[model samples]
Target: MSVDEEQQPSVIEELTDVHFKFEVKEVLLELTRQADQENTLLALSVSQLGAEGKMRTYDLTITSYLRKVGLDYCEIRDSNNQPLHLISSSDKHGSDLLKVEYTKADINGPNFQTTFDNTEQNLKVELSSLDFLLHTKALLSTINYLNTAVPQELTASKDREAKKQVEKAGQGKTVSKGPTNSNVFTFKLSAELGSFRVEVCDDRRNIADITIQGIDGSVLVQAKETMVFARLRDIVVLDVDPKTIHKKAVSMVGEEVFSFQMSLYPNATEGEGYSDTSKVDGKVTMRLGCIQIVYLHKFLMSLLTFLDNFQTAKEALTVATAHAAEKAASSVRDFAQKSFRLSMDVKLKAPLIVVPQSSTSHNAFVVDLGLITVGNSFSLMSAEGFSLPVVLDTMDVKLTQLKLSRTTLKQGSPQTDIEILQPINLEFLVKRNLASSWYNKIPGVEVQGMLKSMNMALGQEDFGVLMKTLRENIGEGSKEHVLDVNKQVARDKAEQHQLEGNEVGCLPVEAGGGGGGGQPAAVTNAGGLGENIVNMLLNLEIKEVVVKLKKSRSDQKESPFLVLHVAQLGIHTNVRQYDMVATTYIKKISMKCLEFSGRWL
Candidate 1:
């Protein structure tokens, strides 16, 4: 005998009793897009198990479009007392590997085959058969094998005693033994796709496990189906408007149906198959709660209703373009100043020759000397002894040659005992050494010519005289003659002053403070010698001037006659001379007094 039977007491007892009944509440299937054309593996599981005993097995057959597509036969029941299990099958391969397993007492045998003959005629069919002739025989064989070597009468008596004890315990007390229970179910279904396993467990009161997986055993969806029982006394029904219900229903199924049609046909646009209500009903019924279903439905419907509202899109595009432009402008401006400086070479750090002069010095140099900026046009100094603002205008500057000129003068004795003068010119060339190699080979002859022209235009005669004197005085060969002439002119002037008895003395005078003084002569003009000479010259006006000539014996020629002219009291005097005397006066008085005297004074 088995351990359980051996341990059984002569007087048996039952623990407790509970009853359960399940009814067809509702069925819902939600499909987002469409079933794959290659067929998909789907699995449904009893997420929860409630009853203590093993659930009775049944056949499941699904039919659509007048075509049968399900397992030949399948039986699925809870294996453990838990309230959840899984059931799965594929739709790719034709249904052939489907099988059913059940309690021997609940079926004709340990396994049963499902036939699709009835499913071919009905689009939907659920068959729950209770024939257990073969199952009962198997259960009896197991019981008998376990309870061996016991008298029939004793077995009957013990069974009755056990029943009595179970009844007595239930009256007021607890019992040690409990009834045998089963609550979990695992099975496999065969479909056009492939075979899939299903597991069910009963852990909670009324929840079932439902899972779908692919042929390669990839999990797709997992769901928990909960069965809620409401007593008639406690049930509350809410009255909803028919219009509201219809609107909610339409909203709930719009996208789902559209997406389904789109998946079925690659060319389908949005809202395809929208008029098909069956697709909408299929998804709407799957919502666990009415409120969620309604909300989703309304949202989908609103999305379609206002899909043409493109004003916001236009505004968004405008704002994006504006932002892009702003960014581009900022980027350009960031380097604008630097780029300008580089291309123009006008920035502060560019190569510069800053000849910074003090205000006073610059003003004096530019204004007093009539100097101008050689290359740059802007003034560095103003006449008011202020630094002039500088502005950059161009970049080309050529350094040219600079030239200097100098002159010197000397005195000579003439026939009237007056002095004659000779002048010398001096020139110095200053050439610029430019850094550029190109300038080294080019002679600056044009530049030198320009300088010479400018000097002549400024003051040719004065410059020539001054330059001639400077050259004679400082030239390499005639330095001694220049010095001696200058000394003789000074001595002659001194002697002339002495002959006139002009002694010079200075005395301070009340005047502005710059060298304010008075001078006195060496001798007063008591004899008026200078005045007498001036009067004698002024009184000499003849009606007809005559010229006389003398011959010099050594020259073997007779000199021509010479006459003199003088201006007296605004009356002009004219004189004529011929021969040597005329030549002598022209060379002596005319040249010396007119040219030399004016320059010297």
Candidate 2:
């Protein structure tokens, strides 16, 4: 079983018996616009908050659409086999709609189970092809409405103050503002740590004030009038307390909220001149119950058989886009319904590892992480249309121990910069070094310029050819089946290995097949671009390596954790396939080192 699957039962047991129901219907909303020719359709001239306290109305229409287009009736139940909640359309919409139900079973014994039942067909297929642009516009419009929907007097005063601040800054004057001063735009949130508020002002400085207050309304944490800057062009703010967030969330929604972080970028359209492209980089932590996740996993596993059908549906939608979209929307209102059944079996594990030496002895590295968790910071640059690529200026990964536990890795004494751009358009540059230890002065390495899109990094045509080759060679099977085959192959090869032992033994043949000539099956099948791709992907280069033994507390010589240090390490892969299903490709890898001593095992 996968690691997640093994821990699924305990994760479910942590949940208390509870149910949830959600029903979405048509909501009529009124919106005001700047009274102009371009926005004159069905618009109302209502006073709104604007710069300089001006009452400017635009000619914009008030449009309303169903929020969740295809949802009908939904229901959920808890572990005690009792109904949690049921949500259905109102009497005005009538009775012919989708209905769904879920049953959560106890995880005490092997017989425990869970189930999901739905009566409709093609619901998910149609939902996948929705036009997200329209939905996004609607959501944004709603938020804008909410932000401006305040008392006219309050809005006017705030707008006038903001205008004065902007005018003063334009004249190169610093108008001092207090930390508690309210701005034109202010947002408040009740979180676990405390009640936090952020005030954004309209000025050249683009500074913001962040304050946290206790339950009694006393200030707890405050970052007053702070200018926002980041390594990534986008400015992101996160407000979350992992330890107490669950408790706070339960009081709000009555459910076990999972770990999550929120990111808000203020100036998304700062750099784009006229390009109509704005990037909103957000990290939303979904509060999906662990019990629900376990059952969802099982349901998805069951749907593997319908992969071909889904592909066919996608192609059909592509051919008749409008017709398929309309049909899918109608099906949700008239046919499909929600249905579910669930059961779970959770396994337990003890935390501590009994043998310390055994834990670190056999592996090259214990942990490997990149920009994923460095200072909780991220950089996001926008791309035109639907393509948003990620570019990492510098990437680093540390190995806990090299050859032995006693030795440590360190950086070089003198730092030297290196840049390598390959003939195939692959590039690498190392500019800095690693850290040193108290025992000695060491050398380090650094590499820069890590940016590429999955398909664009390797030309799309070349990537398609590579994927075709891989799919042909590996064939097709469920994930579990493929893993089983790999394990069996490793076992067979290990048993038949004879190079070191010098024992002559017959080579293993393809599974369920008779022995052929001495040629290996893999070589015979992997022809054409297969061999070239493997060779190109495996190429690695390293600069400068030093290995030394250090004395230990036991009064004897022992191997250090850092066995070798490379002044520079470079890896260039013309085409690296990181994902099989999504077919993601990465182009380059490079980095710098510590200041003291650095080495590898």
Candidate 3:
């Protein structure tokens, strides 16, 4: 009856308490308490949170850890000995957040305080180690995201490097700078191989390299991504000695080493650090002694190899079948002034090589292209007649003194092309039809007389009979009368000077009336040695020969074409006596023609 009578008001305070313990340095235990009179909790511990906290499996209660920090019974007193309290409530913060205040007191109540919100930083934790066997079985998905990115920074850096190259070696010429966009490379970290690989491929290039080792380790440090990125110098210090590593590359909670894995946007680095693996930049020189192109072709896959120096490689390329067909009709004033139309299709062969001529010189090379001609044609038109179409079905060409230079192919565009420098020498094996117009260009009289003489010399035609036909065509009676007068004049001159510079293989024959001393007299069928050895040129077929063909001195401007620049080698052949029989035959003919003068007349 008294207990019920004692509860007079509904506002009876209930007892509330909290406690904590800390086995910290020099401190056995600490605690935080909560009083039944006040709604606020108090720290009663003496140990610091970070200094005393260990990564150990212990109690999970909030009050257990809170007591270790020792926040209860901590207070400030004023001059009047008045106690002060930090007054804060969870309701002051919005939902999903908790705010707490630590206040200090002046002569007034609680004056200075600092507040903390627990929801400001968000951290994510994922554990894939729980299923390590699944990862080994290739059943885990490690790909976090797929992204396509343009590496702007990489492109700018590459362009700057290219510009420097242009200025360094260029002589008033702008080299073709190709597109700087590097091929897209996908990166993968495979738990199966325990390695990471970067893969890149395209029409121009391909690269698949393995890298990033020693990465499987325990984490020693973790920080907010915002703080790490924004204030990077605070976390990492460059120019540090290897000895004083603690000065900071990474500040870990323990002494274990940490491997850093950065996931950045694609536009960060210079997409790929390889322009050419052999030589990247600067001036380079190259030399080769007795090098063969066929070997280089097999080694380089495609055939073309660019060298920065004698040993430093630039680029290796394959032959592209793409051809450029050109049709040109122009007056070739160099030789016989012919108007010609040339339809040529230019094609490249794999493994074009330029070898130096001597040990001292480096500018020249032996250009070996194996073969190029397949369907090229040439046609010439002149005042004398028109030539039949000449087709280049198959041919091989070797050249010397070849040079290389850079030129802009598509001006104002991104790339450039390589062009051969001028004055190249060519050795050729060309097969084509001998146009009848070529022989027809000879004067009709000269052609008729030469054919008749050649036939007589070969014993195929009668020399006496040929001379009789020619005399009839030219009116022999009048010719003989003029010859008598010329013979008399020659006789008078023979008396004045000695016969030192007489006609080759012939003495001046005294005519009955006049003499025709300058011209070669007609041959007669006298059955002599000269008749058996005529036309020796038709007896031999020359397989190899060298002919120097040059343009007329009057042509000031030159063209990069076979027609205008065929200098050291050509299709023309020179008849040379290789056999003893041919040599003997020639000597007999020369001696017989001089001995028997009246027979030639």
Candidate 4:
């Protein structure tokens, strides 16, 4: 029934009903009344029409059960004080035998009642359990309907759409912060990795370039445009088959441009790579970022291992070619094998590594390994007959302006040719010690054992120790730690200066004309080392030759054995070839050294 809003009542009557059907053999039991005009007594009878069942059996059973609990009969009424009359239907296909009608208001009314014989409390509990079961079944059915009725693609699309909106909003918020003087891109991706700030350049809404620098503003990687994703994809290919051909093109929209499996530490919560693109408020926006703490740590550890490997590889190569070396010197019948032992240690101490402006070469990349100090010792020993052991110890060998580059080869199997893009600014040692003595005085076996021990000391354990020390001194990510590191650096510099001021050997050499002074002059031209080398070669000015020899034996301030020291060496050359400039350098050579003392065996 429906009613108009104006006709609706503040409180409306609700209907509640209870129906019970009792089977008496093939017939149903229903409530009936006697035919007496003055009598108000109720009776039970078979409900099925044309049914013939004895009334005595059902009457006795029901009577005994009702009498046992004193719940005589069931009666129901409406809000009014009148009993609901029981009406029998002619067609009882789906009709209940005993049905009572009542209003919700009459549940507690004096005229309304429902009676259950012998097990009323149990029936009430069963009704509540049935209701709960029905509710649960309905809820499960609804969930199943949703799963089956809605397509998976549609659901996934909806989720992607929602995520896209969120990402776009975030992108807009970050990009709108404005640009600085050095960076003009308004859509820059700024992120912090430990104490380093990673700035990603935006190219037409794509992450095209990246620059990493310390918090102190020292650039680790220059802000040069590059195929960032392409390079990463190439690196990823190294894990698979390097010869496998893949799509070189990339895009910022739609599916991911590139993806690589990230190696994670055990029990890592997050590190899986991700990329996203979206459009919000009629403008397209995009984002690409990675959180790779574990991978970064692994890479740094690998770098340390690489440095250690350099020394090990040299020693291994020398040992591997020992037979060839002996064969080359087979003239003398008693000629024995010569062994070369080398020890090298390379460390990165607060280095400012930089990837300078992109190379103009067709297919090449440049990396400037700023200033590196290589501490090494070289020893050459011969066994048995002709025995002269030559040992050279180099102190603080500094290689500066060392730019390493790679150019992709165009022929044969895919390979990148490594090259030094710039001339290495090699500084001659301020101190050198060389010693060559008779090796026959020492046992050959003992000398070999010493070299073997040196090789063993350069194992992974030593590398691990070095890395641990570096990590300890690297400082934390916080500003406070950076401040503390800066203070420590200042203190170390002050101490170094104090010591240098007192030491006579550390004193600066005078810049004398014609023959240069003791100390090698610092490259002070603003145009850089390459420019200076080019200018010197073009001008052809021969001043002095500085010869720095490695030290051997003990590192005491003074040693008996001395190496050749060149005070001056002048070369004269004239241009003879018109086509070949470098080929026209055949000239007279004049050399001079202050001291030379060594045994000529």
Candidate 5:
């Protein structure tokens, strides 16, 4: 619920191959990068549309990840999601546009490219542009969406690439390598709007973001489980054979029972993404469908159970890392079989949120979160030997159906000029931030201390039994439990939360949109992160992502929806710049970005 974020993309303004200039107000830079999430930058600029005429145009730049904005015809637009006028049809990607670039002076090397001194009027360089690139017409169309904006809202740019990536991301996993050549097409979508009663014209296409916020670690747990599944999927490509999968249910935390089944198409036909036999477009693909149980704590333990030397820290660490990883690999290899599509009788939400209609009797306390069944394809065709990089994709799992239930939460802001290092709506990265802090204080025993602390102050003594009773009352319950727990936890969170978990996630950056997508009404602040702790920079590269669009610096008060794809984004500010800087970034996190999103090169 930030005051600055007004993501109203009704129209896009185009600046053709103009000599783009930028000036980063230290205040805007300081406030946004420090106050808002990372990946968001606000700038003041003037670009040229024609080389023949010295026509300098001004722009209020608000962007994240995206480097340059090109208008199709070099025209600008008005607040109404309509174009004021078209600039020139001669506009195109190369000469008519996309000429401005910036080159970062490497810490130890000279920036032979365009170096940004960051003056009010800076020089445009062919050296570097932005991590993302956007155009006018599509952008304007996206911006025009603002006229129809809603209260507490966010939206994704409808760029073709962005649209395709989102469309392709139908709940599946992609093979992630270091940093693929992909662009961020979305931006953070959280907003505080004066209008909304928001209704999607196309429920199938305009699916709402998913929010996960229950007292149970559904958000956190599911995140870890997905990672485990991704890893196993990676291992499967090596074995080159799919097997029949069916595992018995195992109880978790004495409440929910977890089980799994995964089946791949073209059964033992090896080299799907490798040999010509499976080639679809000079590439092979192994279509897979998987269903795994999602018992928050137990499924976690099962993964740990795989390790050779396994020990669970009853305090901070909930699952065994070494042991679970091993077992998970085995499970995935076994589950990666040929042809078996998962069929469900439940109604499907575009990106469905399902909860197991049935559970073990012992699961008296069902958390209602099942393993997120994302049936996407993974690329196994590579020259490297098992270079494990997992991508998030959307697909149909041909095996078992997973269950999950929840709503979405929103957050975001616009920009200022600063070198970007992308960070967006990652609710789970809170664990990384907390982990970073723990590593800072006590590298060895930090995890244990953190777990104990986060749970300690939130619930009342009887809340446990109350939850137990409530679970029994509606064990296989409605979505109310998740919502109630999230709200109650947010309300009960100690006004000042102790920093002990992992410090993960980036700035609340560039243009996409994330109005308060289903964020509970009662919640006012990012859970766990209090006011004092509000900003961060990891000085690290993100290896995986899921966004697919780029946007321009528009007058929209809000930042563009931050895309989950791209290697780096946002203004690069050192984390240690100030403790508060790191804290501010951490404070804007929400729970929706973890399970279902991203892009590929």
Candidate 6:
């Protein structure tokens, strides 16, 4: 028979209650055999109804072996077996049997309470020992069968005989049997619970292939293999704690856990309506044995190990990324420093020189002489002419002297005896002149009458003569005389001195067709021989020289130029190589050139 061809059992259509009674007799001799015996009461009640429609009830009674206490009443003991109270009850029906009222007992050591429910319709009893209660119920059920009313006992025996006859009739008969064929049983295991259908195959060899479905005919357990057959005992145990199965389903399938909920109707037809019925919230537990349980443990362990490895790999990647970022930033900083270093080399290569000129009609000067490079531009100091006094404020030897030379000059008359002073040693002057030749052009202009007048004021010494000459010619009137000469003199005199004292100084004697004579022939009739000599000296190319007159810490003079300044002697280029060099340093570096138009006196 295939599964579909098998007829399913019909559900019970109604409920029936059958009253039950039992007679129990204890052997008196067995009670007397124990020493230290006392009257003992055994408390029990009905606990369950069996599948075969049997009812069980328990009678609690007390018996005494001693004649002193007799059997007048039953003594009740607590759950701990200690006597607590005496109990008795009357039967109004005039029977000798005692009625047992439901009561309670407390066990102090284990802290538990035992109670009994004694309603006449349905009796229930609880005891400290669940095993004792179960045994008592089983005994009562057995006795109830033995002591059933004669008519009911006869009916029960006839039913048993009919079942045996049916089995006998089926024996030796050919019943179609195969894996595909099945016999199904439909029943409610308990009131208010969902219905169940168990399908069994007809072939004995394939008997282990069973399936249990819910009320809606959805399959719950399909036993297609021997392992499921061995799980029969676990399946039966799982029925008690169905929530365990729900939890497992939730863990495995998450939100789909509810899809496996047991239905309330077995074999429910499509579109069929159900009548009003009591419903219960139930669960189903799938009890897997040791093998499946071990498998779940290993699966969880492997999952945890995989997570650990993933975390370690992620941490390593993070560290590598951080290191790469640091290295890149460091490289950028180094490259920037290198680029700045390359740019600095170009900026330091160019040098600058500044020449500031100051002039008046009688004299022109290069004042505030300064030579500057990129390193020392800020140290330039301002002064009045090349010979202006420079105070020695610092002790460093390198800054001992401010180097200076004449830029432009105007010679005074022979009578004026004016002279320009040298401001440094003659040795250093030679070095400067060697470096440049621009100083060779400064002209010497002389008015012989002016020089003779200056000589009359002096006592004829060189220093006195030079001072007297400068005193007369560098005065304010002398400057006016030099500039206003063309404004009053004849055009011939002005033209004769045109190149001599106007914009350019007097022309050189060689250019003027004079032999090595010291004086110019143009001034021969204006002054005496001494006057002519002074005039010639004035016309000599005299470059203004600077003496950086520093006072030496020792007694020795600080510079050779100090003596020339003290003597008021005009520095001549031929007297010292340094004078010539200093003249060149000034001409090349100064904005104004020194022009010489005659020989020295």
Q: What CA root-mean-square deviation does each model show from the true structure?
A: 58.4, 29.9, 42.3, 40.5, 31.4, 60.8
lDDT of 4 by residue, 1-601 (tens): 5666544532322221223334333333333333344332222334432212122211111110010000111233324754322222223254332222211211233222232121111100000000001111122223333344456567558646754654454342331222222222111112211111111111111111122212110111111210111111111101111221211111122222223121111111111210111111111112222211111122233234323323433443444354233333232223222222223344321122222111111232334444545554433333345543333334444546654444442347676644433324444342222221222232211100000000011223223433543343232113323443466467558767645644332221110111231113222211233211111112122232222222233553322232222222333332221221332232233333224533321
Compared with the true structure, the alpha-carbon lDDT of candidate 4 equals 0.27
Model 4 — which ten-residue stretch has the worst lDDT?
A: 123-132
Q: Write the per-residue lDDT of candidate 5 for residues 335-401, one digit (tens) a residue.
A: 2222222222221111221122123222122222222322223222222233321211123322122
Top candidate on lDDT is 4
* Candidate 3: tens digits of C-alpha lDDT, residues 100-195: 122111211121121211121122221111101111001110110000122445534754575465444323334333223222111111211122
User: Which of candidates 2 and 5 is the stronger one according to TM-score?
Assistant: 2
lDDT of each: 0.23, 0.26, 0.24, 0.27, 0.25, 0.23
Error of 6 at 141 (Å): 11
Candidate 3, RMSD to the unseen true structure: 42.3
Identify the candidate with maximal TM-score.
Answer: 2
lDDT value for candidate 1?
A: 0.23
Error of 2 at 380 (Å): 15
Task: Evaluate model 4: give its TM-score.
Answer: 0.14
Of 5 and 6, the candidate ranking higher by TM-score: 5
lDDT of 6 by residue, 1-601 (tens): 7664453221121122343344433222211112267533333222111221222222222211110111211243335775321212222232322222221212221212122221112212211100111121223323233233134446447645754655554343443222221221111111111212222111011111111212121222211111111112111111111211111100111111111223222222112211111211122223221211111221222234323323433544454454334333333321111000000001111111111121122222222212211110001122343221111111111111122222223335432322223222111110111101112121221111111101111112334423533453244334534433434245436556534533212122122222343134223422343311111111112234222222333555332222111122232333222232212221321121112233221
Off by over 4 Å in 5: 1-21, 26-279, 282-601
The per-residue C-alpha lDDT of model 6 at residue 557 equals 31
TM-score (C-alpha, index-matched) for candidate 2: 0.20
Error of 2 at 447 (Å): 8.2
Model 3 scores worst on lDDT over the 10 consecutive residues at: 319-328
